[model samples]
Target chain A: MNKSIIELKDIKRNFKVGNEIVHALRGVSFTVREGEFVTIMGTSGSGKSTLLNILGCLDTPTSGEYLLDGVPVRAMGKNERARLRNHKIGFVFQSYNLLAKTTAVENVELPLMYNSRISASERKGRAVNALTAVGLGDRLMHKSNQMSGGQMQRVAIARALVNDPAVILADEATGNLDTRTSFEILVLFQKLHAEGRTIIFVTHNPEIAQYSSRNIVLRDGQIKEDKVNEHILSAAGALAALPVPAED
Target chain B: MNGTNLFKIALRALNNNKTRAFLTMLGIIIGVASVITMLAIGQGSKKSIQAQIAEMGSNMIMIHPGADMRGGVRQDPSAMQTLKLEDYYNIRDEGKYISAISPSVNSSGQLIYGSHNAPSTIYGVSQDYLTIRQLSVEDGDMFTDQDIQTSAKVCIVGKTVVDNLFPGGGDPVGKVIRFNSIPFRITGVLKSKGYNSMGMDQDDVILAPYTTIMKRILAITYLQGINCSAITEDMTDQAIEDITSILRRNHKLKEDADDDFTIRSQQELSSMMNSTTDLMTILLACIAGISLVVGGIGIMNIMYVSVTERTREIGLRMSVGARGIDILSQFLIEAILISVTGGVIGVILGVGASFAVKYIAHWPIFIQGWSVMLSFIVCTVTGIFFGWYPAKKAAALDPIEAIRYE
Candidate 1:
């Protein structure tokens, strides 16, 4: 029997602008089992980001229910929701929202600061470990200003993983990167998935969704399709296919 | 949130905006400094005045006769010879609270000692006059009781009189001085006591036995006024009462009548001056306190700006598990830190200002420990009170909306 880690039932979000009411999300129902790598694809204003925010515990559904690890999240208090977000959910934004003045290691340690169980030294160690997992171990001290767009995204990924969260929520994590950098970050996501971490990635690009084990397409605030991808790309396979760089 | 962690975060934020934080604290600094400095000046002036009064003799009391109306004309009672030697003797004998008493008679004339002559006052007083007025002999001895009994022509000259009548440094003691051509031997010289508050030269007079002036010079049996000393400051009222009763009996005044003389005690003057200075001090402090309120408002303005600027950070913190109370406490701590730091600096500045006033302006300044502590506490409270709203605004932000804020 597969244990479902996240479940959404007929979730809807309505926004009132002046005199008009806009439905941002409507009758969206979905479920993901443990350790599943799922990607939701959609165009701009397609409600994919809203769905990601709701899944990340950053926002509550206006109607219906959201369950994380079989626990009702919609009815939780603010502190409870924050605790849930800190312990089980981590988010990576499209803009790579790493604090501007902080280094990669410090950015990664941000999530651990919210978790009191970890000592400062241990938090640093775990942050260094997360940065190493994202292949930025040598650039731990480099701030976001000193890093490229791809590197900054990797730092954000490291921050999302540093807490050892149950699920990683990435909202267009590679939307700002070039095609080559996008492939690299997708490979990193695949690597993280291989390590038994569940990930829900939101993207507008179909080529990026090909790296995930499963894909869900959203359109007009509703789920259009959900399917398993037989041709999902593995990180090691993708890396092997890339041409090796010559030592300068 | 743990206090240490909150403090660390507060310190970091303050450090991040050092100049802005300092400017926000400037109001508190100036307010506290001014309060402390003004209180010091006020207290110092009060203390100095008290000291001057005490030096003039804390136990001293002056008596002035009431006005006497004669034949539908208001006359100066002092000129009417209302105060008498018998009344002085009655007060001295009947007043238990009085330590000493002396009757006085004053006349201005040229005092001559061997062709060197100068204009000065001649005061006829009893033996207790020197002690009552806190005067001491610099040379020889005071007039003897024999001088009073026989109405002898002998006197004690003050320092300025001696300097003028005997300018060549000869011994004026035991030497005869001519006052209006009346030969009087100088028996002693009084030590210098600078000018009194009324601009009278305290050490520029010659003192003779009261009987000498009454029988020989003025040919009067009454006194111009009486000077007395109470045993202690607290006994002044009792002494006044006793002297008033004795004088009323001596003067044969009827019951239910006002006393014919007014008694003024040094203690009353001291307290009156002190209260006036205290009121002035409080007024100055109130004026300075207005600046503290303005400073608090400045802090509120800056804190409000800071909260608005860090809305995204607030959202991030809330999303990461910080409660509203946690955010509120953090901001409050930051404000308090600014105020407390400013207060400390202000205290130093106040002390420096006091010293500056003392040395440069030649004014008395007394910095008290309590004033510093009080100002510091007021500053910290101002910071907390003023920053509370901004902190609450920051705390009350919705995490979801804040995180998504552009």
Candidate 2:
């Protein structure tokens, strides 16, 4: 019964390649409601990146009626789209694209810096809160290169959450981590979702869909299947089940 | 984003690569420093030359017999006897702009006192010659008008002549010095003036009444030249015009005929020297300015490299909600900070170098306030002009491609 946070009707994206047109996305339809954890799954060349770009407001559909938080995005200008991206959506990349040599809190404060309404003190407070929420309070002062991959990913998540966007768009947020760290990050995501935050997790790995409330699988630029999971798995339980590695 | 935040961002980026930033600024530093130093030296020399001219009587004018074709052969002005004592008297009586006037004739010969002798020129002139030439008697007295009226053998000796004719450093006054076998009693000694920039020894001269040279030594009725002083430096032209008319009237020259005399003023010499110095100043500044432009290119080069190196960072910032203008201003601000900071340091170094040159090289140096201000404005403009393309390149980058750049 929650309001739709994202709506897409027959979205299509075409690319021109050396005198030929390539259809990247063909007539896709989907809606993500508030507080839903939706996992988008596809193989390589399955148009998941193009779909992610569209969902993140980085790229527009060639033809579609797309709405983000009830605002029609088809007619928006580039700058307006950038503003929309800043105010409504937060992005987390697979590589954890944090500024080099910057501290964790500073990385988290990056998103809020663009918002003129947020004062410096308020930005710092919000960044602190976000880092604490992601369980990185003790690591707030650690530089990006100083932290482990999982910790860096946590900082990226904190950055995403700092703006309090309507939806957090994550592109393989845990792809670079080891099994235990990936599960740990997944547990953090589930925790955030339980707190009523909307998230759209884009991944090529099918195993990640079991942890989310809904799944949309794509193949060759078209939707192969779309389903709501009957039961969501607990990432913390999965982490506990793995055998612990011996310390060096 | 606000300018302060952008400035901080720019500062932080520069801080990350301190060595590269400082190296890039070195070009501007050398450029600005050399510019200031060269200008100071140029201006300093020009001022010193003007002071020397002023000291020699700024309002002084000289009239010499003109070169003319006599019997189908061009004759030297010094060889011509066109300037006469009658012309001198006429200008003295009728010229309104003249403050002082004197007829001049000289006899170059060996001067001797006992066993000492030196080759020098004895200038025969009225007492007004001393005032017109800015000469002051350091000791004894100047000759009286009675000496000229009677054509008495009295003369003043300059320092060099005194030194040569009285090598014992004894007083030359009341001593008799023989000029070309003609003996004359010394009435005064001129104060010493050392060698000028042109290496001319001003102190090596003798002065006596023109009538003494014309009637007693040279045995001629025509005068060689006339020296006059205008009422003021600004009245030199009017004085020359007045003297020219009087001389023409005395000579009874036709209306369209050229004069048999040439008139020259210290103002004209001063202007000629000034033009020469100004040309040198401009040439030095132009050479210095080339290095500044090269320095600006250095800034552009580094900015381009910086933009390329931070492509991913730019993408991340754009991803985080920074607009294109924000990215542009950030890089532009960084370039500006580098140039302006270097400019300030250059100003300090330049001033220090000017003083160093003055003390160490013994060269005159004068620092103008306008040079410093000019460097500041030039460096700022250089930052904007050179930094623009690179910053624009950074701003116009596609966020997706930039983020994924290897």
Candidate 3:
């Protein structure tokens, strides 16, 4: 049995919105083992965003125990949490948040700047490898604004993987892409998952959830379903079966 | 993150938007330039005045006859002639730290030599007047003691007088020049000293013996003023004290009675001019310093806008393991870089402007090293001081909210 990299026990989050207590997340418990590709599915009001924040260590749960790689992260200070995020986790946002006008390789090198042990040469090598892993080796000097949305997303993935973290937390990783580009990104995710990297993907679309090894559904601030995916789909096979646009 | 990396990031960000960075630096550049240039002008004028006064002699002192306090009005010192030749001789023989002494009297008259004529002041002074007043003769010789004893009508002409009375460039030495219808033989031609700080032509006078002026020209027994030099510049006060005591004893004034002479020293002239120039320098600096404050505010304004505009960028950096202090330092470094770069350019421009004023505008300008260093330090401080609030606001931002900011 694989050891769990992320374990959440009885997590609760509350927000005071104009004098009324809105329960964003209520007693949500889940464990993500190492090397598993898990998809968290929910609607806009389902508290999945709150849960993702807690998992990414960007926010602390009001009442819960969060063990990230067996270290208690919820009790850590601000600086300690930053350290944990640098070494233990990586983030992929839907907006492909690469600095505009910055080259691809330099964008990939951003996270390693916060890592002290890595030398400049080592950081460059790691950045090149991460970008190559996402099939952007030839576009090393391409600026994000100068590249397509799909290419920009790949650069963001390279940034997330540069630190070789224990977990990758992606929120709507392919939400901004078209059908074909989304499938291509999902294929890249499958490849990273095959390389034994733990990924927690959050999406509102059920179609994206079919690619994960495990599927989680949240409703009314609680988990409605936490089950293994019985019929795992291949994003690459899906991409290949679709008809290419004539303009492309 | 380390400072090097943080600075590199800031430099890169600035390099990306070259125009915006330069525009921001313009304020500091103008501010520093104005401050240095103004100070240079004031300093240069002060130095020139000091030099002119030193030419008059730093260790020298003058004794002028006391003013006539008549009832409710006081007449000028030149109208009174209470000093006598006996008092001048007594101070010369008995005063300590005395190096040179001369009795001086003056009268203005139209000078005529051959066909050329000029109106000039004829100064009555002894042979010691040349060395005590730092005067040198370009031709012939100064009047002698025998001429003073015999009351001879011999005069030494200055450069302006020579140029005016002998326009043909002929030697005026050994020639007779008529002063108020009296023929006086010219003994020497003084060197040209040019214009003084007050714009007065310094070389527009003639020197004669005091005995000739008192016995022959004006026929007066009293003296106008006594000019004396101290052995050294530092001993001028003691020299003045000694001269005052000797003159009071020789004149036989009562214990509580005031002396009938007033004293003037070269130091007084220098210090009075120094204070005036110092006031001008401070006023100029204060006015220019206002622009510096405005420049600092410009940096603050831009940095604040930068923090607001780069909210998502801040979020991304925070998520990638950058601490609050790290974000703060990055923004702070950006501000410092702008101001410091501006300061350097401002110094270059200010020094250039000083030279330009000195050469092109014909204005005196001295650029002190301390002024440049002071403005440079001010620019750096302005960068950090004004950058603090914006950087703090950026550092205190919530990472989650910042990432979500549009």
Question: Which one is best on TM-score?
Answer: 3
In model 1, what lDDT does residue B226 have? Answer: 89
Per-residue error for B23 in candidate 2, Å, reads 1.8
lDDT per residue (tens digit) for residues B83-115 in model 1: 888788788888899898888888888887777
lDDT of 2 by residue, A1-248 (tens): 99999999999999999999999999999999999999999988999999998888878999998999999998887778778888888888999999888889888988777777888899899999999999999998998889999999999999999989999999998888898999999999999999999999999888899999999999989999999999999999999999998999
Best by DockQ: 3
Question: How does each model score on TM-score?
Answer: 0.90, 0.95, 0.97
Best-to-worst ranking by DockQ: 3, 2, 1
Clashing pairs in 2: none
For model 3, residues A132-202, the per-residue Cα lDDT tens digits are 99999999999888999999999999899999999999999999999999999999999999999999999
True contacts kept of each: 0.34, 0.36, 0.60
TM-score of chain B of 1: 0.92
- Of the two candidates 1 and 2, the one with more favorable DockQ, higher being better, is 2
Error of 1 at B65 (Å): 2.1
